[model samples]
Structure formats: C-alpha cells, structure tokens
Target: MIGRPISRIKRVVLSALSVLLLLLSYTWISHRQHQINPQDTTIPSWGQLAEGAKKFTQPDRKGHRWLIEDSIATGKRLAAGISLGIIFGFLIGMFMGCIASVEAFLQPPISLLAKVPQTAALAVYFVFFGTGMKMYVAMIAFGVIPALAVTVYLAIKDIPSEMLDKAYTLGASHFETAYEVVFKQVLPKFIDAVRLCIGPAIVFLIAAEMVVGDVGFGYRIRLQFKLTNMNVVYPYLVFLAGFGYLLDYGLRFLQSKICPWYQNDSK
Candidate 1:
C-alpha cells in the first residue's frame, strides 16, 4: 500500500520535473537565438509573432471568419484521412501479426516503401488525384498508415503463445481465439499506437493540405506566406497547435476509457 502511493508520487514528480526541464531548455534556446543568429535575416522573434497572432485573430471581430465553405472542406478532408488511416492500419497490422505468409510477402516492400518521404510520395498522388480533399486525404493516409500499421503489428506480435493455447484448449477456433485472446490483449497497445500517431497525422494532414489544398488552414498559411503575412501565419500556427493538442487529448481520453488495463502506463 505504501509502495503504491510512493510510486504514484514519484511518477507525478518526474513528469513535473520533465516539463520544467523542457521549459528551461526552450527558454535557453530562445535567449541564445539573438546572439547566435545575429546574421539570420528572415526569422521573426517569438514576441513579434505573438503580436502578429493578435492582429490576425482580430479580423474575426468583424463577425465573418474566413469562409464556412472552407471550414466544411477542411472537415471533410480530415475525416477522409482518418477513416482511411484507421482501416489500412487495422488491415495491415492484423495481417502482419497473424499471418506469417502475408507478413513475409509484404514486409520488405512495405519497409522499402516507408523509406520515401510522404511529401515526396504526395507529389505523384496529387498529380493522379488532381488535388482537392481527395488528394489531401490520400496523402494524409499514406503518411499515417505505415507507421500505425507497424505499431499494431508489433502489438499483435507481442502476444504470448500460452495465451493462445489457453484459449484453444477451451475449444476456440483460431479466429475466435484471436478475437477473444489476441484482440483483447492488444487493445491497450492499439490505443497507444493511435495516441502516438494522432499528433503526427494532424501535422502531416496540414502539410498535405498545404501542398495541394485550396481552402484549408494549410492553404491559408501558404497563401499568406507568399505575401509575407506573418500576422496571418502566426494565428494559423496557434490554431494548429491547439487543434493538435486537443486531438492528442482526445486519444488519451479514449485510451483511458477503452484500455483500462493501461491507465497507469507512463508512456
């Protein structure tokens, strides 16, 4: 009983310490930026950017924000990517984990495919798909799918033979054993993989949108970037940061609810 409380305290203390250290590092880096990059011409300081954010955001006070049409486009783009990402992740992960033949046939090519940057791959996808939300979702799914599949594959691979055996002895078929034994056991890891990928997927989603999208935040940023409108860029970046944080938090909450077995894991 005493040990449990002490362990919990240690975890909290360590997390706090880690965050404090990160803040200090950021502070140190910011302080050194002026001296080390005195010759750097184009980069704006954080303080200047903060003011720009205020300026950009103030436009919303006029009552009409960007465009409702653009908002709908962005939502559709996001949903499309998420839907495909999850489906591909589940399929490939299940195959790699449960089927040795499938894993053997596809593993090397997939590994090789993963080497090319998603940005590079998106160039061709955009060309074939001819841009818009379809291309955006395709790019986001490509960027997100491989890594998430590997995460799920590894989770499935970690299942012990003894658990499978126990289920089999109880008259379960391979499919049933997998569903009942393997699937339940991997719930925590699957949730974890989703949590890990959620942030990166959002980042890549914006990047994908910026490359080929006409109306999303990414497009907005790129358009303003051409105009050297730091005011607009800063607000969008702030919006992105908040959006990503919420996506991560949502995954965490879902993880907590679905995988109660892992509620205590520090990772």
Candidate 2:
C-alpha cells in the first residue's frame, strides 16, 4: 500500500482539501493578528489583498503597469538564462559522457562548480558582468548549468551497454552512436533535469533582482518590504507561485507530448 495508486477523483479531492486547509489556517492567523493590532500590515486580510491586486491592474505614477513591466523584464531574462544553460549543459554533458578524455578533463571542474553556492557568489557575478540584465542572466545560467550538466552526464551513463553494442554492430559511427543512439535515450530525462533546475534558476534571478534590479518581481518585493507594504508583497508572492506552477505545468505537458512512451511517478 505504500506505493499504491489512488483514484483520480480521490487525488483531486485530497489536493483541494489540502489547499483549503492552508487558506483557512492563514485566514485564521491573519484574523487573530488583526484583532491584536487593528493597523497591522504584516498579515493582510482579504480586503488588503484586494487592494494589493488593484496595484497590479492600475498603472503607477510613471504610467506603467507594474505587472506587465515586471513580467516582461523577468520573463526575458529567465528565458535567455535558462535557454543558454540548457543548451550548454546538454552539450558539455553529452561530450563528457561519450568521450573518456573529455570526462576526465571536465568532471573535476564541473563537480567543483556544482558544489559552489551560486547565490553566495552574487558579488563575483556582479564584478564580472556588472549590475544589469547580463548579471541576472549569468547568475541564473551558472546556478543551474552545473546541475543540469551532471544530470545529463548521469543519465547518459545509465544507458545499457548492450544498446550501444547493438548500434555499433549495426555499423553506426561513433558520432551516430552518440547522438542517434544516446541522445534519444536521454532526451526525456534531460527535460526532467531541466524541470528540476527551474527553481534554482528562478532563485538566482530573483536574488540578483533584489540586490540591483530596477524592475522585476524581486525588485518590487524588496521595495514593498522596505515600506512594510505586506499587502503588495503577499499578492506578489501568490502571483509568483502561480507563474511557477504554470511553467511547471507547461513542461509536464511538453514532456507528455514528446515522450509519451516515457512514464514516471511525477504526478
């Protein structure tokens, strides 16, 4: 029963119940906090949240909607960073996995990079890339690249030796065997690795934004927090959560479509 599957209806019901319980608990805690201090802005009520939601819809004094501006800025940086990271990581990992010499040369450095705390190295990124979009993109790419590369490397290693032998017996060249044979086997797992890197990528981007961002979710959150504007902060957090969920859902959908034969217990 430990790994038993549940009905779809049960899964839906249980998921809804969990979310309902969380909301109820938060509301109760907010109510109690409000009772103690009528002007408390720490735990905003539903009304405060509604007001905060309006901030997203309405333009600021500069006549720019915060939501659209932040979304575009953040989205572009994130897309650029993650795309670079994935492309380079996959290439490096594929080479390392296929070529013994490459593995011997690159493994130590990549392993060391993976151990490095990317967020803590914010100043290093700033020094190299300066305080602009480049810094944010570099931070995110570096933060996730090592892990993504390692994931691909491991996935490649996990391929059965017999498959490779068969491909060779069929007269496949080394390049053909590496790409046509190995690449296809690892594509799904690589996508899954990318999914896992999403969180860290976002964290790196946000951290950079908080420190030196002119416009983005992290910048807005930091500004509001300084002003004790919990109302906006809370709604911003919810929006971020929703954004992340949508991204994850999109990836899952993509994986299901492309790798229909591949199955996992992700859900």
Best by lDDT: 2
Local lDDT at 267 for model 1: 41
- Candidate 2 at 91: error in angstroms? 0.5
Summarize candidate 1's per-residue lDDT along 1-267 as a digit string, tens digits: 554545778989999999899767755665577578753223445665666666544446666455353456666787788779878977888888899999998788767766768766767886877776677787778777777778778887888888888888999998898788877777777767766776766777677777767677777778878877665676577676776678778888887887776786654
- Clash pairs, model 1 backbone: none
Cα distance off (Å), candidate 2, residue 169: 0.9
- Please give each candidate's TM-score: 0.76, 0.97
In angstroms, the error of model 1 at 72 is 4.3
Candidate-wise lDDT, in order: 0.73, 0.89
Q: What are the root-mean-square deviations of the candidates from the true structure over C-alphas?
A: 4.8, 1.5
The clash tally of candidate 2 reads 0
List the lowest-lDDT window of 10 residues for candidate 1: 39-48
